[model samples]
Target chain A: MTLFDYIADRWDRLALQSWLHVSEVVQSTLLAAVLGVLIGVAVYRSPVGSAVATGLASTILTIPSFALLGLLIPVFGLGPTPAVVALVLYALLPITRNTIVGLAGVDPAVTDAAKGIGMGRLAVLTRVELRLAWPAILAGMRVATQMLMGIAVIAAYAKGPGLGGEVFSGLTRAGSANATNQALAGTLGVVVLALLLEGVYFFIARFTVSRGIRG
Target chain B: MSDVDVTGLSSEPGLKRADRVRLLAQPLAVLVVVGAVLVWAFARETDEIEAESIQAGVLLTKTWEHLLITVVVTAIVVGVAVPLGAMLTRRWAKPVAPVFLGIANIGQAAPALGVLVLFFLWTGWEGLWAAALPIAFYSLLPVLRNTIVGIQSVDPSLVDAARGIGMSPRSVLLRVEMPLALPMVLAGIRTSLVLAVGTATLAFFVNGGGLGELVDTGYKLNRPAVLVVGAVLAVGLALVVDWLGALAEQLLGPKGLG
Candidate 1:
């Protein structure tokens, strides 16, 4: 069967998998961003703290995703839990590092000006520093999201949601009718979704970046 | 897979305290963690199935296969990407450089596992070449990109000076541009190395036997010891390789550049 015909035949199931794939990745990216930004905030003030935080996060990145899944399977059991945990861990480095880099990149003079204007420390941070650092933090999120897309595919090994199942099922059914189509659909679906997310991020940056700082 | 320097190897150029600590501590940590895991796995009681997969001979062979795939893939990536990147940076090749990078960016977006399985299906091939080929494609972007960026970032005035001194273009490229670009190229290679090692774990999916096979075997057969051993060993190997890459970056770059 032609690839187009194959996709058409399984359009509903393919659509659901695509949604689940994006959903899982988006949720994981958001979760990592929250945790990463907090870590970045906590550590950015101290050089040593920033180094340690980024160091540990990058070490996690070095671990192969499959191995990490294997390590987690025993602890988290199969399904989305292990998958999500692995995705979050993988996403942390970029977000946290960027958060640190972004926050640190903010000019001390700007913070001092806010202080001189009678803003409290919390107000200075929330109103000024974070706004200025939003672009870098968003860039980090962008990187993490792109990365988690591929990883969520691997997470399918643990019976995690999304297009990865199609790839694995296709692998198992190799040499059979429609196997190639199945794998191609899954693979291409991810690439397409990743591109789509890239657009989403573009719009997000457009709308969310403070007007004065938009680039 | 656009090969971000996830490991932060290039984040700080000089030997800061953190770099020194990591340089001394990473391999030591790998040794301790991997050794402890191996000892625990062997010391534990096991069923026949677990014992079969967890034997020293079996573990060693699997680790060897995993390293072999990583090495082969890294070699192919460096060989292909370095020259390709260098060519793309040439004045005549500039117009098409983005085209190559665009293709690579899309390739990077395609999942590594997808790339591997698709390659296996397309070629009807298996074993090392099957695994190595697709992975090389997946990991090539980093080195290729860095090579172009490295060469392009060279100061034009430096090139002008070399030309004014009667140096040939080829010699200028060899002695001037390349040495200056070495650190970036090496940093890119390190990222590719880590990627190749990580992706090599999936080689077993294509019958290219590696540490991942043990992972699959353990997962399939319900043997946590086997699974942990496989996972830990793969993790350990990647750390060691990354550490080695960092060391090379520190030692191999041309002097006086830092």
Candidate 2:
């Protein structure tokens, strides 16, 4: 088949709404990103929490993704829960590190000034620091999102949803060539998602920085 | 440099070693608490595979073979990626760099296991090249990107000065740009090396030689001891690689560290 035919075939899967695989990928990504961001923010607010989370995330990053999924299965059971948990674990390092680094990057002077003007702690954080830190923080999110996009495909081992199903099915069928199409499709889908997410982050990061401070 | 001068330049807080330990304070304590809890959780599991009869001597030989594989793959990755990255950063490389980068990203995203499976089937699973090809693919992006960035980030003035001194382009690159880019390039090498080590663990799943045998064994039998041993060794290796990178940065001195 021509390359256009291949792309057209994949794009058509997106149109059908019958592509349970695409939906699974989106769901897994959203779940992982949201959880990662929330946990990342929590770690940012507390030093003890940051240290513990960093160590845990460091340890998790060391674990092979499939093996981690295998370990998660008995505890979380088959399907999205285990996979989501694994993705979230995989994502923590980038997001949490970025959150901490971004927050730390915010100038102490600016925060003190806001507080001097009687801004509350949360107000100072939200208005002054977070605004300034948004670009770096977004960069972190971009990294995590991209990393998660790639890893979600591997979550198929746990019977979790995604294009991994096609790849795995192709493998099991013993048609390595046939598997290539699925693997290729899955890879293309991930790259598209990564580029889109990175582009969005750049747009948002630029906007946030322009609005928050002078260059 | 005198110890006092070094101490003045270091941005770390002026705490003695004893004070640093003491100030480990609550964060260190919390880490210990969380670690203990995780150990308990992992230990609670009972069902697992019976221990395999692979002798310790055999396991050691296998580990040595795996390390050799990792080193060879890493060297090949660096050999290709560093030069390629330098070439990509040149004015002429603009068109091709993005394409290479896109391919690298896809390689990073796609499951290497699938790639390994495909290669094994295609090449009849004949030799170590089956494992090396996928790993070299994995190592490419970091090594390449870092090389480009590191070279590009070199102070323009340094390059100009080297040129003004009538040095050839090659000598300028080696003496000026590379020295400046060494730390960043080293960081990329470190990332690829650690990644190679981790990915090599997956090699065992494909019956390629490596410490992955232990990890795969643990996975198959659900044996926590073996799993723990495998996981710990893998993590330790990663940490050691990272430390080695840090050491390299330090040894290259302040200019490279920057």
Candidate 3:
């Protein structure tokens, strides 16, 4: 059978699971973003400390995910939890780097005015610095979300959830066209997911920055 | 005289340098501390595992092989990507650059394992070209995007001035614009190189080369030593590339003329 015919034949069976998998993957991204923000904020507060934290988080990125999963098996063990954690560790660098860069990129003149007007430190950060850094911080989130979407599938390699199962299954069967079709389909799903998430975050970024800043 | 003329006093450059040095110390110390801890932990693990000849060779030879494969693939990638990128940057070629880069981003988003599997089937792991195929494509997008951006971002007036001086378009591009655009292009190369190194290790799944041998061996047999050794070597490769890229950028100078 032709590749399209093969995929068409399997579509009914694959549809429900793909939908469920995409939902779980979406949830995973949200969880990662919330956790990542906490990590980013913690790292940003201290001057010397942020550098050390940034290095450590980035070094974590270099470690192979499978190896990390194996290492973590002793602690978190075999499921979405470990997978999400691994994805989060990998996601931290782009998010935190951008946060630091964005916060630092704020205009010093605006910061001076805020301080001169007797705003508290927290007020300066929330009302002034963060507002200016919104676009950059959003850009960072866009990158992180895109990265995690692909990674979530690879998390499937360790037997976690999402479309990677199809891809991995295809590899095991040794040249079956059905398997090949499935793998390609799953990969397409991931690309679509990535683009959708990117568009959403981009729109949100525009809204946030526009509303937060005067001009 | 009584006002002390504070505005005329120069700031201390030495003190400024000292303060910068102090600011950098904590991060350097943290990196050293982390490296030492990782080494100690791995050493302890290695001691627990009985070493064999293959394992012994894996520690040294595999790393060298992985590095070799990584360099070869990256060189091939740069060779193809630079010309393609340059061609895509021309005004007439503008619309098509995104099509190429979009395909590249898809290539990137596709997990390395998936590509390796697909390539393995498409070309039965029987030759070097099979391994090079996916890696070269995977590294293309950043190089291509950076080249287009780098070239297009060049000061238009500078190109005009070179033209005004009667330099050939080729000479202007080669001597004037290319040098000016080199830093951004190099930045893309740096990213591509580090990524190729990490991704090349995934080639172990298809028995392609070097450090991935350790990665595969460790995973299949549950040997942490091989895995750690492989991973450490991979990371060390990235660090070396990063440092080398930094050195190249510095030597090339902020001017990019070098």
Complex DockQ per candidate: 0.60, 0.29, 0.23
The TM-score of predicted model 2 comes to 0.76
Q: Give the per-residue lDDT digits (tens) of candidate 2, residues B1-258.
A: 011100011112321221223223324443564356336534555443423413456456656766776788788988999888888887777889889888886777656665665565555563466788777787667778778888989889989999999999888988888778876677677677766766776676446767666655665665655654554444445445444544554566445353
For candidate 1, lDDT tens digit of each residue in B185-223?
A: 998999999999999999999999999999989999988
Tens digit of lDDT per residue, candidate 3, span B40-76?
6446635434254134454667767666767787788
Which residue ranges in model 3 land beyond 4 Å of their true spot? A1-32, A39-50, A64-70, A73-75, A112-119, A210-215, B1-50, B126-128, B253-258
Fnat measured on candidate 1:
0.65
Global lDDT of model 1? 0.90
User: In candidate 1, how many Å is residue A124 off?
Assistant: 1.1
Superposition error at B187 for model 3 (Å): 0.6
Give the higher-DockQ candidate: 1 or 3.
Answer: 1
The order by descending lDDT is 1, 3, 2
Chain B: TM-scores of all predictions: 0.95, 0.74, 0.77
